[model samples]
Target chain A: MLEVRDLHAYYGKSHILQGVDLDVGEGEIVSLLGRNGVGRSTTLKAIIGEVPPEGSISFKGEEIAGRKSHVIARKGLGYVPENRDIFPTLTLRQNLILGQKSARAQGRWSIEDAFELFPNLRERADISAGVLSGGEQQMLTICRTMMGDPDLVMIDEPTEGLAPQIVERVGRLIEEIAARGVAILLVEQKLTIALHISARIYVMGHGRITFEGTPEDLRGNEQIRKEWLEV
Target chain B: MEVFVFSLFNGVLYGMLLFLLASGLTLIFSMMGVLNFAHASFFMLGAYFAYQISQPLGFWPALIAAPILVGVLGAAVERYALRPVHRFGHVAELLFTFGLAFVIEEVVQMIWGKVPVPYDVPPSLNVTAFAWQGLDYSVYRLFMLLISVGIFVALFFGLTRTRIGLIIRASLTHPHMVASLGHDVPKVFMWTFGVGCALAGVAGVIGGNVLGTEPGMAIQLGPIVFVVIVVGGLGSLGGALIASLLIGVLNNMAISYDFSLYPIFSLLGVEREAEGILADLVSLTTGAIAPLVPYLLLVLMLILRPRGLFGTRDV
Candidate 1:
């Protein structure tokens, strides 16, 4: 379980995450939806301790807001950045190896499971990650975090630039992740995938949460979608 | 032929020494993105430490102990001095290291005095390894060559084969991502700095006797190391090797030849009595300009190929 309360973050003097609050129950899929530059990414960044957080954030009943990124990570939190920051010079397998909290520990997932989930990664396991296409890189980044075997993983825009069929595959993978009982806090711009996958959805506007409800409740609210989500 | 053979061996020996220093410098730069001005100071420290340790325990123990001691000092410096300055941005970091070089030099002088210490090759290794023509190569020089080559092989494998090595390569490009993956990146940095310094220390232990263990030794060898990395291409281990050997062999050949530009000038139909700068240039012998070879190569590389020979990214 994760609980965020009154979170505030800043870049220079301009406040990005202004007094935000959200939650994700154990094994639940929660999507944070917003337009560009509305602090969706910053919210995830603050929760993970990459950006300096001003409020309390509790992961599985322990406060983790101001801790260092690696410490928070060892506490079983994983983050996949929006840019898919794969170590371009490293091999695909090396990228996965780095994701593991410890090399010896057995986790819920294995490199084999990652390969099974997507066979393409196995085909190019020895090659450097730089040569991977955008879709393959997205899969690698997600699977890289999965190798850490975190109780909860925060993914920012996993399908932002992906092709349509790859987007469908990513959707299936998200479902597979939740099926394994790992909580996901997904930051997304596309409402269709969010509506299809998320158990609960929180729509954000101007650095604050404007709406929070189940997928059915969001689908019926045309006014909320028009004002906050629709371009 | 004898001159050529002797110069070739001497050049390779010197090149290996340069590689020992350049490899560490390249690793630290690639990992931390800090152009450590005090790297040569670490080399200087290694020699000084080896000299002091050898005074009591002899060269063999000094060779082992000196690098470990310098490594601990390097780690401590990273933790206390460099880490604090890191938050203030790269210029601050650069100035800090730049100042660190002067401080290290002053400290060495205060303790060791301004003069070169009597750090001699061990008596056991003082005998000639072999003789070619009239030139005899000492066992100590061969020993230096062996140690340098051994370190290179070890370093190469250590980086490419080990898990920690894998982590280091990742951190070089994605420090934040590596941290979020649960690696203690700062600790990685501290150790990286330590290991890099330890390498310089190894060079110091072997090189002190050969190069002379003086306070000014760091300053004297500092610029050439920069030339090496820049010409090799910044942050490339393979590039560093090629650049070091290129500069080393070129310098040795220049020094051995003792030829002047006068013949070329005559062939170009220049007046024999060419005035001022032209006369000065014509009269300059290769041996006299040997010291300037690396710098000249560095300038040429920057002008023609700024990214370096094996660099993946631009310098």
Candidate 2:
């Protein structure tokens, strides 16, 4: 479970995330839906301690706001950034190995499990990650984060720039992650996938959550979709 | 034939030493993106530490201890001094290291005086290993060669085969992503700086006596090490090795052969009756201008291929 209250973040003098409140219960897949730049990504970053957060962020109980990124990560919070930040020079296998918190400890997910999920990674295990296609790299990033076996993962736009088929695969991967009892806070652009996968959806606008409801509640609300989510 | 063999051996010896220093410099450069100006200063410190330790303990123990000391110092510098200045950007980091180099040189002068210390090779390794065409090669030189080669092999395997090595290589490109993966990236950086300095220390331990342990030694070899990395390619270790050997052999061959450009020019049907700078240039022996070969290579490499021999990234 994760709890965030009045989270505020900034980029120099310009304010980015202002008084944003959200939550993700245990084993739940929650989607943060918003058009272009409503501070959805910054909300995830603030929670992960990448950009310094002003308000309280309690994950599974303890306060994690403004802690060092690595410390926050070790406390069972995993972050997959928007850019698909795979170690380009390193081999795919090496990238996964580097993701492990400790090489000695066996986590919920093993390298084999990841490879089984995406057989393409296993086939190109020895090749450098840079040569991987956009979709493969996206899969690698998610699998790499899963190697750490985090209790809660905040993925920022995993489907961005990916093909429709790959986007569907990524959507299934999120469901698979949740099936293993790992909580997910997804920052998604595609409405169909978000509406289908997320148990609870929070629509954001201007660094604040404007709507929170179930899929049916969101599908029924025409005004909230037009005002906040529509381009 | 004898001259060629001897020159080749000496060139390789020198090349290996250069690699020892350059490998560390390249590792630190690739990881931190700071072209540590104090790198050769760490090399200098290694020699001084070895000399100081060897005086009281012995050469063998000093060989182990000196590099460790220098490595610790390097880690501390990264944590306390460099890390704070890092936020201010690369210019601040460069200036800090540049000033640190001068400060280290002054400190060495103060402690050991303005003269070179008598850090001779250990007695066991002083004798000749073999003789070829009446030319005798010392065992110490061979020992230095072996040590450097061994370290290179170990370093190669360590980087490619180990888990921490994987983390380090990853950190070289994605420091923040690595941290978010539950890794202590700052600690990785500290250890990387320490290991790099320790490598320079190892070079100093072996190379000190041969090159002479003195205050000006760092200044003497600093530029050449930079040349090695730049010529090899900025972040590529394989490039550093190739560039080191190339420069090393080129310099040694130039020194060994006193041949002038007159013969080549005459062969090309150009007369050597020029005046002023042209006359001097035509008459100059390769041996006389041996020192400028690496710089010339650097200039040429920059002009022709800025990315370097094996580098994927541009300098």
Candidate 3:
């Protein structure tokens, strides 16, 4: 389980997250839903130690607020940044090998398991990452993230730029990952995909969590969606 | 003809020495994106260390020991100095290195005095290796060639065939991603920097005897090595080799050629002793070309092929 309690995060002097609190239980798929620039990504970044947060962060009961991002990663957290940020010049194989640095075979994900999930990656293993199509890049990014065999994976916009079909495939993949008993913190813009895959959803607006409920509660309540999530 | 052969041999020997210096520089530049101004100072330290150590131990041991000492010193600098300044940005890193170079030079002067250490060829390799086309090639020069070739081969294999090598290659293009993958990227940077400085040290050990281990050698040789890296392109090792050899051969041919030996003059019935207008032309060409060859090559390379002849990426 991961817990963020009254987090206050900033980018320079500009305060981004003001008293934000959220949680994801063991093996649960949680989605942070919001319109653009709501500090959803910043919340994920703060939890993973990419950005400094002036609040308590407890991951499985260990405080990790001001630790380095890499150190936090070694403690069984995997972060996929918003941009995919794959090494452009390196081959897919090299990028995948890098993910194995924190890999644990018994924890669920393996190199062979990833390749089975994303078959296109196996075919294009030797090719440069930049040349992959947007959808393929998304698959590779997800596969690369899984290579770390993280206890909790933070996926930031995995389906952002992909086509509708690719987005659906990624939604299914997220569901599959959750079914395998691995926790995921997904930051997603597409409400349909977010609502379809996540068990519990939190709507964020302007750096604060506006609403949190079960999937049925969120779907039935139109007021909170219009106030915070609607364009 | 004999002078041509001698100069040609000297050029190759000097070229290999330049390669050793430039390889370290280019690797550090590619990985860190900082032009280490103190690189030549490390080379100078290598010379001084070898000069001092060879007196107590033998020349062979001095060669082995000096580079290790320089590598340790380089690691210490990376840990204590470079890491602290790395957060400030690239320009600050460059300035730090420049200051480091100045400090290293002053330190060397304090420890070794402002005198050129007398570094001599080892007695075991002091004799002539061969006489070819009426010219003598010292065994020491041949020894330098052998060592340089061996190093190039080893470096090539190490960078291409090892796990750490793959990580370094990955680091060259994407340093942050390499760290994010859970590998200790700082340790990689430190080791690469240390190895780079150690290479400069090895080059200094062999070159000291040939070029003379003067206190001012680093200042004198630094620009030429920079010229080699620039002409060789920024990230390509192949470019370094071609540029080193090209500059070497050109420098040799420029100095050794006497234009009075031109067959056209003999055919035209121009007297060899008449001191014609061509004689002054030849004298000017000879006077201006030796020190300027590498610079001229650098300028031409920058203008025509900015990425260098074999570079895969832009400068």
Candidate 4:
């Protein structure tokens, strides 16, 4: 549903993303894997119009490169930043309400559905989001993006700082979201989960995709992982 | 006792008016994180608009129309003037607003002249509302009190009980998150500035006659409102109310009481009307300098409660 070709982005004078090319089809889970500071996050940001992409970004056949972030969001492109940007001062309920395109617009996800998926959110729906645990905040950031009901979601590091159990839950949640016909572009640090879940994996190094293959193909090629991914 | 009561009532009336002005300042500052140095200029615009509108349509219509006109002007300024300078960082934006205030004052003087415009209270509400303690309070004062109270109530309800208000409150904290949710955030900021200036405009409509509408009107009221915001806390509406009322009452009391430090000296048998720096310091007590009270509160709040009474961020 999304097509990106020869994407390049910059931070001031420094080139952060250099000629990156990738795509994700309908309901397909694609993983972008790399070591820290390899432009994986910048690739997603460039696609989502945060970094001002230099090349081409066609999302469902629309030229969206250099568009404003909100305009991209309106075009059914949801972005969850790596930092887990939650409104700390706002209550969890208000945050969710803010996530929707319109309060009255009917979508597949409801507030009740979110509450059911994570009972912790339901219990503290009325309190400030700042007080939530890191894992709960991660859940909130993911679920909050789902409230927008984007056709394609670019999530950056969803499992960062999360416990193993919570990380498993995040993996399941991604699977559930993909099953519901939503395409996901996941930027993950952990290799095992990305390999297990992603239909296709793109190993990034030095601002470009060094390797792109199926999970089995990636497993067979240890040279690519040792050079681009392993610490 | 009667003097004390006089200051008390007048303080309340003035305090409410200050709240009317400061609440808008609070909203704009808290949401946009821009100080909006031009806020009081909007208040001045409201008064001038009321003066111009009331000339043809009369006082009541001007009261309603002036604020709306000023609000639109505020929105346009946000879109054109303020938004353009945002790229240069907050200091440039602040300087832009500061320069805008100067331009507004100069334009106001050119249009209305350097002299104060004859923006008087309506003839119908000129009569006395009530008399107590040998004082006859004008009905206009009561109207001002009632109108300010109404604004406070409406603003409170609108912000707390509506979806738009919820969005505004959320925007105050997480602007990017709201935008990611598909809101045109710049539009939200423009409207926020508009709403804030509208509230100030409304304050100017009622406060014009009492405070006087002149070129220096903004200069006089602007710093006080900033003081109100700072002392209240940078982002807390509740804190603004408390600070406004507190500043208002202290200002009046300070003006009314000629309670010099001479009393302590006299108690110590140091004598009256003595010469030198010690006597000069003692002679100059809380009298006729109401402006000092806000600055005092500001300093104390800065030193004691830097985050303000309810502010989460230290500004």
Residue pair clashes in candidate 4: none
> Candidate 2 regions off by >4 Å?
B263-271
lDDT, residue B279, model 1 = 82
- Clashes by residue pair, model 3: none
Which candidate comes out best when scored by DockQ?
2
DockQ of each: 0.86, 0.87, 0.40, 0.64
lDDT of 1 by residue, A211-231 (tens): 999999999999999999999
lDDT of 4 at A121: 88
Question: Model 4: residues >4 Å from true position, as ranges?
Answer: B1-5, B263-273
Candidate 2 on A78-146: residue-level lDDT in tens? 999999999998889988998799989678999999999999889999999999999999999999999
Better-scoring candidate (TM-score), 1 or 2: 1
Which residue window of length 10 is worst by lDDT in model 4 chain B? B281-290
**Please, what is the TM-score per model?**
0.98, 0.97, 0.89, 0.96
Best by TM-score: 1
lDDT score of residue A18 within candidate 1: 85
Q: Write the per-residue lDDT of candidate 4 for residues B4-60, one digit (tens) a residue.
A: 888888888888888877888888888877888899999999999999999999999
Residue B200's lDDT within candidate 2 is 94
